[model samples]
Target: MSTSRKKSRKARASRESSKPSKRTIYTAIALVSACAVTAVAIGLSTGDSDDGGKDATAATGAQPSLPGALGADGKGAKGKNGKPKKTEEPWDGKVKVLGDGSTSYTGPQPNQPKAEKLKPGQQPPQFIVFSWDGALQGDDRLFSHFRQVARDSNAQMTFFLSGMYLLPKSKRELYRPPQHKPGSAAISFATDPHIRDTLEQLRGAWQDGHEIGSHFNGHFCGAKGGDDWSTEEWKSEIKQQYSFVQNWKTNTGYTDIDPLPFDYTKELVGGRAPCLEGQKTLIPAAKSFGWRYDASSPGDFQLWPSKIDDVWNFPLQLLPYPKSEKQVLSMDFNFLYNQSGDSTEGDPAKYDEWLKLTRGGYLNGFERVYNGSRAPMFIGNHFENWNGGIYMQAIEDTMREACPREGVRCVSFRQLADWLDAQDPAVLAKLRGLDPAQAPDWKTFLK
Candidate 1:
């Protein structure tokens, strides 16, 4: 990281600590129904919590090999050493600019893995998706940093970009969020420099083979949020999300930057809702647009994904919270809510311990599926440096440790969906049936 970037991170952290608002609250409103099994309570929203508890896990030693797990090249019958081989770019076509030069069609995306069906008696690769919400390139430069992180780790990720991040604060009234005043929003609009930086990051991210999805606009939660909106209201919100991104060149009146490399309508295939709420209506609205998946559901076990109404329901998962029987949602906010209770800046003396516990919890989840069922792991995060930047460190460490392991493929949600679509449905059903710790005899199981 550069000196200027380090200073920016410290300045952002200071600002967040001094002026906490509804957007920075990180509150847990109510636990998801699935968490009832483990007697754990947590919610997804912006608020406060008073319960500060710590938990750790015993290491599940010795990874049991999947008998016939495929290697990185996607053709070999078993695992191999070193980094997974990335596929070459599939298209070399002419760019076609569209709609006032805000976006263009640049042919098929590059460096994506080929979605091949599992051979008979072969085990599937271990997949882990590291996604970011509210993808903004603030003064902290986190968006740009993580792009380099992904390149180093040989991973492709999903960045749910907030549409309003592109619309300047000067033109705030251009947005009319449902059930709120024309310009009102739960989150702050990006500054002019931040908007420009975010645009550059989005452009590079897509070109680098990362999926640029939506975080919607305005980011309303709790009352009058996605929860309260009807299907039609959800439709209106979705429409505005597209409008803001598609018309950013007009909205910002900037001419020097190149148009985004891919068309928004075709590139955008999914999104995660604010607070992981409103999937009930959001799904229907999304389906109308032919979206392939939705990642807004709050909690589920670390198992293979299944469809809801023919749309891939990619929910945030529940991972083992170390040193306890309870499970926490696989998101940075949940970890912060549990360890420090509503405070982004917790006790300084405990920062190292908290970082260990956070990193351990994710690793525990990874080891379970890695050695046993081989289900995909979904880890979500934000760019904000909460708890002295421990969570950001935890994620980066996890990616470096996990992505290069044999038979492990760190992919974007879109790539995961494509792989799932190519598999035999009955085989997927069988794989989904295995417990998170149940390593099966692949030769017999798939046969």
Candidate 2:
């Protein structure tokens, strides 16, 4: 052998001699066995039969056999007749659905004896007003609740919404994941993935024959950290709002299904001021936007052309708050607490009071309007408040009491507009002539 080869072989033998021997291998195997035994004992002590079975399977590669019954085709399993069982139908979970039908706006006139009594085929002056404000806050439970209330009352309500809430932001961050609140469950209402889910819900309401109106962009203002924008700012915001709705329509192919009847032209029509802050500036700005009617005012319920333009102002007659002294006191406290951000302690009593007051106010307002023969009552409520089970029940109860009564017709803004459009030119002209500031009372009109 060469000297170099002998030197290399000696070096290799020395390295091999330095390596650990069978003792180390035995030690590792013993440690692994101890761990497996410990795990099995612990699992058994914990009463985990499955763990024991798994361990046994791992050790032996053996599993308990299933039933040996053969199918008609001699398959592994069989049905009652001994034939191979077919796969079961998918477990379609329960799904909620709404009804389909158009709600009427005009009811049969009150009396028929006198010559001045509404002539046959001559419909009474009916006004339809839609208000959209404060919809779908934290989970759409409120929105859903409001829909149910409206359904029960057979009242077709319109909703106007700002697209800002529909946007993804910290406002909606808490709803992102894991929490699974009502509004968060659907990706359609998400900020980045802004789908037409909200719109579709509204459109479904529309398809079922309800009104869908715009609440304006960034109009959430109030105790909730909402935008405190001016009239000009609001106008700019509404432009964005309009664009968002348009985008949703385009993306969802809703434009193909049913294009919005009113465009920017033809007085794109009804709107409710953000925060009910319908100042003088809003009226003029609304006119400039070619809006034919606005529902934020607290004046008479009648509709007339805007003071600035030909638009109409259908003032909101009632909010879902009670008229009792206790209710008022509670509301005042809640308002203060909410404003101060100290409402961490929710008051169900206060909420109930507010509900009672709201329901009472609605009932009173309805009576006032119907009894006086003024325009239809333009009632308003937030999706947030209306969604409360108690509040929703109160609303349903009040509407049930009022909607079926004489001279009371629950209608939406679109239906009101359509009815107005179909009215006699002279009546419309007379309505136009009547000063909105001091219109004839319902009593006078009815008399």
Candidate 3:
């Protein structure tokens, strides 16, 4: 590491030490079980609520600022005063329906930018991956809403689809989650209509260049949750995720609906474990299925990513809580937990304030990496409308403000891994060595 990097680390530690200890990061995760009921009772449950709203996949450190504004005409950043950007190209190949006709093989995914090796001394683009867990399209229509948001912001996100969402409740017994009864699940199974809507969103999301990764089946957490699962059990879970997605047609018995526009087995490259637990075994289980990345880590600082057991470990980062010396995890549940304790329905009066803080926290993280180390920002969220849907609003606003900025690429985990793989190992090593806020001399750094 360079002198600047050393100073940056020291400054970060000092700032952290100065803050009054409120809640420990692990404590934040442990508190999820208490709040799970609120998310579920609201009927917006994505099946991960029982595990604290699906993958807090987060940790604490640093902060971010400045909200952005954009329109939703589907023109992306290029049509406005914002920076010029690329848009998705239409797929030209004929679709070949795959097994059981639940999914099909469209050619290569559209709107994907080719991952090119960075030139020596060239500055890295700030990368932001906005990933969703339990990607179910309930009555809220959030799944479709964010898809439009991505198109308007020149962004492509990762939707971590829960396998149970594709498996109708009537066919629930077919799902054999390890350690749990064959038909039992922590959260509610998707209603048939919701499942149909979710399937539509999944089809369109992939066609629009978004990545469809797994959030695994049956959002189990804590005790018998992912945290306690053995490697073999995790492998069983992984296989079932594939099984549910690939055989949704068989399970749903919907003859009128078209097959999903991509082969899930081939398209799946990574996943975030429910409640961000069980990653120790999850990593090996994921790797066995040729996964390229895993976003199941509980927490880490906002830094450049590194591989764990050769699989890209994309942990949710901690960001500075706005206007405070303290930091919060980058996921919505952490923000919700901090603001209202275990209750999802906090002070309605403070909704505006909470939303402001949440947006600021994300922007603070974004601003830090965008202006500093250019480390990739990985933000995890669900589609629930907790706390009057403030978290959802905050994320949408952040996307508009950040995605269209110069030298920023709002992409998916698979895309990030692709870009990382395209770089020289030494270059990546040097990049990862710098502090999150340390902007080094690029020429010498790469040289």
Question: Which portions of model 3 show Cα errors greater than 4 Å?
Answer: 1-94
Residues 172-245, model 2: lDDT tens digits? 32221211221121112334333334543554565455655665543322222012334554454345444444
lDDT of 1: 0.74
Compute the lDDT of residue 125 as modeled in candidate 3. Answer: 90
Please list the C-alpha lDDT of all candidates, in the order they appear.
Answer: 0.74, 0.38, 0.73
Off by over 4 Å in 2: 1-130, 137-140, 165-196, 220-234, 249-268, 298-308, 318-346, 349-354, 385-389, 421-447
Measured by lDDT, the strongest candidate is 1
| TM-score of every model versus the real structure | 0.83, 0.51, 0.81
Q: For model 1, what is the alpha-carbon lDDT of residue 39?
A: 17
**lDDT (0-100) at residue 334 of candidate 2?**
24
- Candidate 1 stretches with Cα past 4 Å from truth are 1-26, 29-92
